[model samples]
Target: MKDPVLSHVRGTPNLLLGNYDLTALGYTVDEYFVAGTAVSYRPVGELGVDGHWDVVPAERADYLTRAVTVVPADGARFNGTVVVEWLNVSGGLDAPAVWLMAHRELLRAGYAYVGVSAQRVGIEGGAALVGDLSLKTLDPQRYAPLTHPGDAFAFDLFSQLGAVVRHRGDELLGDLRPERILAVGESQSAMFLTTYLNAVAPLAEIYDGYLVHSRFGPAAPLDGRSILDPDTVASLPCPRFRDDLRTPVLAVITETDLVGGVLPGYCTAGQPDEKFLRVWEIPGAAHADNYTIQGAFLDSGRAPIEDLAQAFRPTDTLMGRRLDRFLNFAPQHHYVLHAAIARLDDWVRTGRPAPAAARIALTDDESPTIATDSHGIARDGVRTPWVDTPLAATSGLNTESDRMSKLFGSGELFDTAHLHRRYPGGRTEYLTEFTTALDRTIAAGFLTSADRQEILELTAITAEWRFDPGAFHQSGSVR
Candidate 1:
């Protein structure tokens, strides 16, 4: 494979929800356009239901795409790990969803982060996640030269970017030598990453590991069809990761992803964990929770406790419109994901495997629903203080009246009576129980100790918030 040419881009990068100051965190953010010919893939034989996709290079097209990279300002601070995020266009724009979720860990630990605009929706523009924002439309003069040959070629485009970062790190990272490269994507990008892991990773041999977060059952087809093409999507088959895997894959699933929302759920494709694969099903988590929509962009690792407190507040609005219920503000999804990233890095670099986790308990119904405990929190899966030491009921299912709000999930704090009954001793008793659960969660490897103080601090804030009558603004629910 030929190397792609990289030229520094001189303008404001139009990254959706990319609001953090990398410079303040001892990192520098830059944009570059990588130009080269990328090859699209086709199934070698029939596209089977099993994720063991056999594909070969089918068509070649010349393309130019942009990538935003955040690296340590002082090269000596580089931690030798580069996380390449397949920027999601589910919202009709390039969104660093995973980056938003795990930036605190990445920045604090000195890992470099890169967001690639690989999909057609990011470049050409279509649909609308948070308005019809795209590279071309955001800043015409700056991104005018960028071109993407549809999503059929997206797999190759992503692979090529990984190759550049792996083989030619100095070109992009200066003195930073990348020891391990992990490919991560969420939601729409996760679906595409699932296809990439099954098909392209075998041939390209680019990434050291893969993190497929919040993916639906069916992957984006190898052919040029996207999520927008319902006719083509309806005809495709759901796939499970091939049993014989070479690289390590950490699949993280939330309640909204396991069960159906607007699209098919991943429950159909669930498979047993192999030596190289680990599936973590999280209960009481949503596809896009409060941290995803609000906190991720603002929490830059500086004020960890203060920023995390923001996610605890309940709200019914999304983007702009008011929703039927409060958005799922459970912080477990974001905190657990931080640990997942750390575990993947260790697994790739030291040959250690991440501990296996229980799947979220579900009903036996054909269209399964997550089984919940008395508090309405999902049962089993990765246990956390939020669920075990509960003060409120949180769920990944919410109203489907609004298309975008469906993923935000729902939450309702326990009424004053229920709260009093659950913890008669009040704030002190709640903290004691919450702390015990937090310790156990960390020991079990679901939460990292590096984030322990922050978690405890956030919990303390939650205790104060819930105890304060002024903060309990919801009337009907408080009775």
Candidate 2:
């Protein structure tokens, strides 16, 4: 299949052999490119001042060198421009595949998208070498240089990309100047962004904002803590090096598997004035189920695209209603998701603050009813009392409740539509304590009215003292 956009770039080869010899090993090579057009508009203050938007394709150059093209919105009008470096995080997932899924919203929002294949492991020749050598046997010292060259190459490539974008401004884009550039990454790539920002802060003034999603890193052995510790990871001090970082940053943290880790560390760290940390604890969402389960908010049909091109506007009353299903799982976090996108677009276009915190209900027992707070002190209460009781005294209650928390928290109850099912009334008294504790928290104003209403509705249909059989069946566990 021919790529419509890349077919037009002059002197660009139809097929480029990368570091690997695919035919020699009976493997097929997949060609990915950065291909998209540009959009032009006027700046807010200056009525006549024009700006351009670009959409580029992702590509692989010489060994370890991955190049992505940036097409300006008005490629014919800019003198200088900005390049967006998009990094992928999933261990072996293709970065371009992820971008293709989410790029429509980005293109309409008026920013160029540049997707890089961050992992050499998934590339043509790179994959073959790892398979031949057996990743398990390769030594870290010897393997690091060959397998993961993308890590070191990203820093230089991004810096050079900015220079190239600036140089091509007159010919490709109009009289635009390459003033601001942004690096955005998700998951494991988020960790790399931190490393890159720290490593290149001294010479490059191009980076203006960073958008990190689901950031993860090596955990400490002693306490299972993330490597977000400043002393442990030398890269954290990079944000401090910038004298005046007009560049604003937004972090969207999903509370799927990131319970007590680097996310909390990054939030608390005192840093740049333009730096803002927002945690979106999406309730009931599995680690990578964001796309499948939370697809309602995304415009999957042709409506969003039509709306962007001024062809038609969608008036589906069900659009917002469909979004409500996932909202209860993580209300605050969902708001942050939209807010981060809006803020990034605003920063690129008008240089404004991200949308103010939208009105979201805070649940009283968001973490655990018994967990510690920001002060690092454990909270004590009648529900999660601090009394010195024997393990046997609370063993039955602890065992049952802990099991229930996992069941309800996993979102299987809703998935199975077992809200109306009743469990055998074997442990009514213990269950009452759990429900009552939830009620008391609501009454104490810790939980919002909406939260109380939802809980009450859920409880009414739920079995008073037993686990839902359907949930247990789906989970393949019994207690």
Candidate 3:
């Protein structure tokens, strides 16, 4: 399959993403590139039924129009690699998974970031349908002209975007050339990439590599729901990754995903196949975490608390979030995600395959559950100081008052009674243990030297809570 022809492209002259000013957030309207193209790619494999792909000969061509918010080269702090981050349009909003956490790292490394709006929710929807959740509703003037064909055409649209960006990058990214472009998507988009890599990728051959973060199974249908067969919907949840990925692919799943049965029984962390596949089912991490909420807004230069307030259910007001404060349970998955990006770059650039990681241990039961250590921490996944440091008993699985926060997980620091029993030597011994855990994490390649300052800063935050538990306690509580 040849790359798509850039039939037409018109930039959004005065772009406004959400409520934030472009310049204040660093990237601006002048960097915007909107394109329409003729995409011809065959769906060779019969989604759930067939293994070997054969692009359906009859329906190979589709036209798509999409947007890419470009970060100009001169203004970019690029790290030689150009990252094409797929905007996660779940809940009908443009949520950038990587840019949320890796903003600081990306800026430091000088990597040019492009946020692609390739899905319908980011394009066609208006207030009548999706309300404030719709990009068009929030800012109709800026997003009025945007449109998407449907999910069926999304893969080809994404492929075309990458193809166009690689060959015609100057028009989009300016002087910053993409040394290597890794296609990245998270959760819902990750599921799409699973299909994209298995089906479209074998044909299009566009991206250098892929980072399919926080994925389970399920490939979207090749045609829209009005045309989708019922069996296709049932079978979507159980598709496999292609063995013949011409490029390296890294998949990072959290313990929350594992225990919750996001991946089917066959898709374990260590699958017996290609050297290009690396899956890290991390312990003490959540699907949508507290850090992600705060960091995501902070990185995008939005008001963190207020934005969260508007997005969450009305019952979950800003004051409730401010009051029910406890140390977060899960470690930020983005920390490891950033490292995987670096590792994947090395693998793509020099053919140095990353070391395969040990999978998280699960319990012996029909329903999947995590195997635990004496401290009740999940075992065998990416070992972070969060699980090893021993201040709070934190797990990726959470039970909260609401479904949304419940899925994100919870953290409970050891009460003074429990702390004294666990760490009799107090803060001194705890600090020593934390230092040891930090060393172990760094040695294991889970953490890089660049992360030292951030991790140390976190330890300080924990220390404050360690001595003054009241800082995060309920007003009526007696400690």
Candidate 4:
């Protein structure tokens, strides 16, 4: 468990200082490889399955592939290793910025990381292939069409991309036989991870975890929006992909990514009780901005990098004094990654998910609502100022609209004795009324949590035979 020392590049140590500057950053180069000729391909736009666009492959060629090993400057203790595979964002084989970030993070976290260029677009001889596709063109419509099924370019590229990583990862980590191996990808790389998992999961026993962030896919006609829609879920050809996945997955979604909309929807569609589907919804962050902004790719804040840097320091190192110098970036993203890694690590060591926090009851109300406490009694502004009632007190109610409205408004005694009997006590009667109103509100899709609570509480208080200020329920209080 000693902090791993960053190893130096073997031969041509001077070249490392001149080119990539690994030693300057405290990272030791473990190994490096220059892959052979790049693969040449053509993008032929044609209609494919389900009327979707696909790239009809025209040709193939060899290209240079570069693989590098990055280990921490001051190696931290880690029980596992992670392989960072970045999908070609520009459909080129060049090194990606995100890959660099992943390299830095993995090294700092005390895990050895390897980055491989999947295609020839960014590598030597990539110019010929990139020139064929004209990736320099920035038209969204053109890009969208090229990504469809009829075009075999994207599909073929991603398939090969996954193959290359699986081969390289197996070769590099053969002796280490690390306890856990994770494949991390972002954006297009995220989609590549999905493709890889579909094809390689059963065969690749070495891989224990998959982390897909900001996934993008083909667009669906129904939404005509991003392809990350529920409808497009059918587009993925992998059979029972979720049910069959043996490895745990961490699917991260950013609020602003329209292309990632299907992630949450897909997670919800699958069996949530399964340990494999770990979903995290990050708020107020754009796709990959959490890492880019902190890494100085954007002009927002420097705190995230500094925070990560501090985590890299030795235990006895006085990181507290310099903490103030770094900007204060929100830790939610970092924590999300940390949490996923921790869960994956735990599962690697013990054949089960790590202990999870109690499932909090999600509220439809927008105003930060919480459920009843351990006693199962929550007070809303209705029964007693501190109403004592079960968390789902409003579960039972009739479906009729008018009766429901009256019950939710000022408490009213229905002429039918049967109704009162069915509702039981005054609180029950009010809750039934509120539930009905809530049902209607849900249908209309306009009611906020505060509005629903107000309606329910008003109905309850109005029905009380004896009123007392102290007896009124307070909103959000769990009795």
Candidate 1 per-residue lDDT over residues 89-162, each given as its tens digit: 88888889898888878988889998998898888898654567888887888889999888888999999899
User: For residues 400-427, could you state the per-residue lDDT of candidate 3 as single tens digits?
Assistant: 5543454465456667887788778887
Note each model's CA RMSD in angstroms.
Answer: 2.1, 16.3, 5.2, 17.9
What global local distance difference test value does model 2 have?
0.34
Model 2, 283-392: lDDT tens per residue?
22223332322332243233333222111011111223221111112112222343355456456657655532211122255442224333222223212110111000
lDDT against true structure, model 1: 0.86
Task: Work out the TM-score per prediction.
Answer: 0.96, 0.45, 0.82, 0.45
Better of 1 and 3 by lDDT: 1
Task: Evaluate residue 294 in candidate 4 and report its C-alpha lDDT on the 0 to 100 scale.
Answer: 35
For each candidate, how many residue pairs have backbone atoms clashing (under 3 Å)? 1, 31, 11, 32
For model 1, name the residue pairs that clash: 91-129
Better of 3 and 4 by lDDT: 3
Ranking by lDDT: 1, 3, 4, 2
lDDT of 4: 0.37
Which portions of model 2 show Cα errors greater than 4 Å? 1-64, 68-83, 96-102, 124-150, 169-180, 217-246, 260-287, 290-338, 355-409, 412-479
| Top candidate when judged by TM-score against the true structure | 1
lDDT of 2 at 464: 25
